[model samples]
Target: MSKNILIVDDSMSLRQVVSIALTGAGYNVIEAGDGNEALTKLNGDKIHLIVSDVNMPGMDGITFVSHVKQDANYKFTPIIMLTTESQQEMIQKGKELGVKAWLVKPFKPEQMLDAVSKLILP
Candidate 1:
């Protein structure tokens, strides 16, 4: 199956890079600049997984994840934090909000693909 994946980041470069990588890997990619954009896209698309950056201009990744998990309609869609924050507290907070995985920034395409495959396919 071609998975529909959402990539949310405030960095335009990061969003482009990740979107390209995921598209090349055969997944349908949706790019969002911030949490609000991500949520808007979620309303119209059937996204299988969400990869988001922790820090954003409006509605951070942590807040986004909490909102997504709280919404009964999208509670089952898996989310992974792909950010520069390696702090344990931040990771724990993400887990509390129902994030499936946490990946530190400067990630390789292989690493992102691996995590997505594991979450979506397993």
Candidate 2:
């Protein structure tokens, strides 16, 4: 079975872009507009990885990661923070929440693919 990826972001364009890139790389892509939506999807899906953005309307990426890590069922899933924020504090917060990797926004498709490939087996 193909690896399933959950992409949490507010920007439709970014979600589409990431979906396209990952789909081309042979992974199933699921999307959520915010942290709440992501949490909802989490219950019904079998996700192999999570790619999230830091700033969003309701729940932010850091908070989302925190919730996921706190839940025993989802604690071990690999999550990558993909956002424009490059601040050390933001990255550190993600690290504390068990985020597997952090990639700054405007990242190349190949860079994301490489990260996912390394994290999830094909």
Query: Candidate 1's residue-wise lDDT over 1-122, tens digit each?
Result: 68889899999999898998889989988889999988898785577888999999989998888888888778999888999999999999988888999999899999988998899853
> Number of backbone collisions per candidate, in order?
0, 0
lDDT of candidates 1 onward, in order:
0.89, 0.91
Model 1 lowest lDDT segment of ten: 38-47
Q: Name the regions of candidate 1 deviating beyond 4 angstroms.
A: none
Error of 2 at 105 (Å): 0.9
Candidate 2 C-alpha lDDT tens digits along 3-59:
999999999999999999999988899999999999998894678899999999999
